[model samples]
Target chain A: MRDLVFRNLRGRPGKTGALVLLVTFLSLTLCGGGLVLSSLRAGLNSLENRLGADVIVMPSKAALKTDLDTLFLQGTIGPYYMNMSTVNKIGRTEGIGRMTTQVFLSSMRASCCSIPIQVIGFDPETDFTVQSWLAQSRQGTLKDGELLVGTKVNVNVGESIKLYNVSCPVAGRLAPTGTGLDTAVYCNLNTIRSLMAAAGALGGYSYINGDPAETISAVYIKAADGVNVDDIVNSINIHVRKVQAVRTRSMVTGVADSLGGVSRTVTVLMVVIWLLIWVILLVAFALLAGERKREFAALRVCGMSRARLSGLVFAEAFCVSAAGAVLGILLSLVLVRSFSSLIEGALGLPFLLPSSGTVAALATVSMLVCLLAGPIASAVSARKLSRVDTGLILREG
Target chain B: MDLKAQNISKRFYRKAGESNYFYAVRETDLELPSGALSVLMGRSGSGKTTLLSMLSGLLSPDTGTVTADGRDLYSMDDRKLSAFRAARISVMPQGRAVLDTLSAWENVFLNARIAGVRDESLVPRALELMERFGIPDLKEALPKELSGGELRRVMLCRSLLLSPEVLMCDEPTGDLDDQNTALVLDSLRDYAHQGHTVLLVTHEADAVSYADRLLQMDAGRISTPDPV
Candidate 1:
């Protein structure tokens, strides 16, 4: 069978062109779908892993869509103040394991490189998710007056950079995560408060001289091992007024659900494109089969069974599809890497370049589609060619 | 073994306006003995080619059976019949039916490969056949590049590649010069002398002068053979 396929493939004409088109289409779909789907999956996974806290209590006025958009899309920083007195109240509540406060601060800075950088301030000891990634870096931790920069930070180690009128040393650099982390800078919460204090913007600084308030923007609560996150969120929401506690699991699910409409749109568009391609391929192959009518008829007369003849057509398509897929994958990789920023800008979401697994899956799907299509088109052609009476023509000749 | 078609009949339907079915080949009986060259002579539009097609298992006879080596040709399914013909019989249809993409040698070897002969040595065999037919250097040439006579000889070589037990030729020497005609007839005689059954269908008398026997066809029925 392999020999038969090889011989038929070699004997087939117009194969190179067909192969090029097949691979082009497959590679584009695979690579495009891979990049988008993988990025979405990775982003959701990263968000889920990093939230660390089982439940987040925020102001009820904070809309879910607005908060998510601010956190992930616009990268906007929103501040909510609840008294530190509430922390003790939350700790004493049943089913609560541990609680830590976090203050969010962001600043856009243009350096010698001229690219704007977004800085984030958090408590190092309390921020478990950031700490985990930090531990993986060569320089393990961040110190007061020191900062951790992501892979795209573009600053040299130990470089002095001024943020909010304070010069801080770069302590460590993060690995490239192909996420928004690549564009972020991290510093301790104290440093952010100090900067705000110098600017007369710190809480209680105006009324109490330099005796700053120990208040935080948000508090993260970890649930007891046996506690259900959804139940905790519901319980907290019921007890606390004007505050909404969201579970990490529910947040991820909510985001995915919201993105469902976009996914559906993408899916419908992909299907329409695929159908168009199918029609085009059908016409192309039908004409190709028509042009080879004499050849197929001769093959029939030469004792090639209808099955084998159809197999030959399928084999040719398989070879073409395989070759096209390989070329498409290589092309897609280059395309994703080069155009990721454009895609991110267009979609208003983070885009990750496709991984090896993603590429393989795409190629496999493309090849399967091509293989299946070949036989269907060939069967249509084969039926017409096989039934042709060569007898009259042979006698005339 | 002898090739025989016993009272074979076939009727083809015309378009809706046509009142009757077209009788392609009706009650045609023919025979070709092993090591004998027999030609079915007829003009254009004659049912000679249709009869040969039925005999070769390319078409099923509506009312009779075709037998070779005492095995009924029409008894097997389409797949088995195709395999049987590919393995044991060779047909050189009118005109040069060589595959255009393959080289002369590859085209010939392809026939053998299709018949389940996969030896690399088939290359040499193809070359030898091409050399014997006086187109040795043309082995690597594409069929489109070959002249009419050269293409005809290549087709014959391809047919002979499997060393089929039965060799059927439909106008094997059509549109050829006297020299090319003699070349093809001589090759056919050589094939027949090697104990293979040979059946030739042609309109020209000179084309079948080398045949051991001759059969005439008129209106889809074969007359008794006139001894050569």
Candidate 2:
């Protein structure tokens, strides 16, 4: 039986090759779609956890000026300014639990810095979000002039980066959040004040008497337990002067909606292609069985049992499908890995590859589906061929 | 083993699920006993092939029963019957019976392989049969690479490879020249003389001369020639 299977596959080059190609197409679609969906789900789950704050109060015009979701996702708040008094006023609000102030500054693409990057200056005493993330990689408190780098910062710990003529040694690198935060840099408030002084001396500082201590960019707040987050957000927006309050869920909801649309389209496309492959296989096998009726009849006349005959057909199908699966999996992995950044940019969503085990599991599932496709599609024709009237087929010619 | 069909009849419907049908082989009794060649003669559409199919256990008759070696052929399950055929009977079908994927050598040994038996000892015998049929050099050649005459010989070699108790050939020499035709008919006669039951159907006059007994079929009915 093995001999016969191999002989058929080797002998019928055209049929075998065509079947393999079809299965490869199916596998490619399954794997590629699975990866994209998995990556998006992972990114969304991570995003939800990363956005620990309930409401962010930014300068009123900053909401109109910046893409808020992108800002939250990337860790880059615009260089918007509001009085430090705004943080105190928001802290005194009725339902505010814990709040932290962040100052936003931009690096110059001058002789001092190679690339322009967003510099986030977080206060050690009042901060909430960055501390937990920082603890995942290190234990020591962040000291002045020592920087924490994001995953995309490209500088290693202990490496010195020049910002506004002041050199800071990187203390640690944060884990990826699959957002613009990966590319941004973090520091203590004292470092930003020094950078601000350096900028003022360099004639680069233009804003408000160059005073870094009196202003803050945004205030991240967590509402009190059982308090209505929406009410807290509304209170801050109404009572707080010259600032806009934004809920973190809105950013998450926006991404969730986009992910929902993507999942629907991918699901539909996968189903349509599967149906098309099945129909094409059914027609192709029926025609192939028809063309080879006399040969099958010859096998039957040679005393090949119906069961054996059908087994032979399925064995051949398995060969074709398995070959196609290997090719499809390899091709799909390469395509997804290579184009992930492009896929992220195009989808306008945070993207990250799932773990190796997850990817391998997807491949195995896709392979099983591809393997079953050929046998399932070939079932009717195989039975028909096995049950053919030997004498009649010979007589037809 | 003897191959026989008792009062067998076969009808084929022109359309599925329709009452309109015609008999391809009418009610008749057929018995091919061992040790001699019995040839059935017929013209086109005369039903010789239909009767042969029922007797060879390839087709189920509409009525009556077919038996081989004292056991009802149709009564046995497909597995048992097919195994019986593989061990004791060989059927050489008419017209382009070679599996297109396999080489001539593989096709010769196809019956034994399909029967789940790997008789490596048949290698020498297979080559000998291929040599006798003048297709020895074409052993590695695919069916598409062979001529019609060569293809017929491949099927013939395959049928005789197992040296079963019963042998049935239908128009086995159709594509052959006169020399090859005589060669094939002589082979069939020799096969029968070896104490095997040989039942063949052909329109060739040369085939009738080589038969120990001649039978005639017309419009799905059989008649005897009582040929000397």
DockQ of each: 0.41, 0.71
lDDT of 2 by residue, B28-132 (tens): 887788988999998788888888888888888899998887899899888888898888888887777777888888888888887667777899999888888
Would you estimate the TM-scores of all the predictions?
0.81, 0.91
lDDT of 2 at A300: 85
Off by over 4 Å in 1: A1-15, A23-31, A54-68, A78-98, A103-115, A136-139, A151-182, A190-254, A328-340, A349-397, B16-20, B118-125, B223-228
lDDT (Cα) of model 2 = 0.84
Which residue runs does candidate 2 get wrong by more than 4 Å?
Answer: A64-66, A73-77, A108-112, A124-126, A134-173, A192-209, A213-215, B14-20
| Model 1, span A54-126: residue lDDT tens | 7777656567445644555444546454555665566566888767666555543433222355556677766
lDDT of each: 0.70, 0.84
- Quote fnat for model 1: 0.49
For each candidate in turn, give its C-alpha RMSD to the true structure in angstroms: 4.8, 2.9
| Top model number, TM-score | 2
When candidate 2 is compared with the true two-chain complex, its DockQ is 0.71
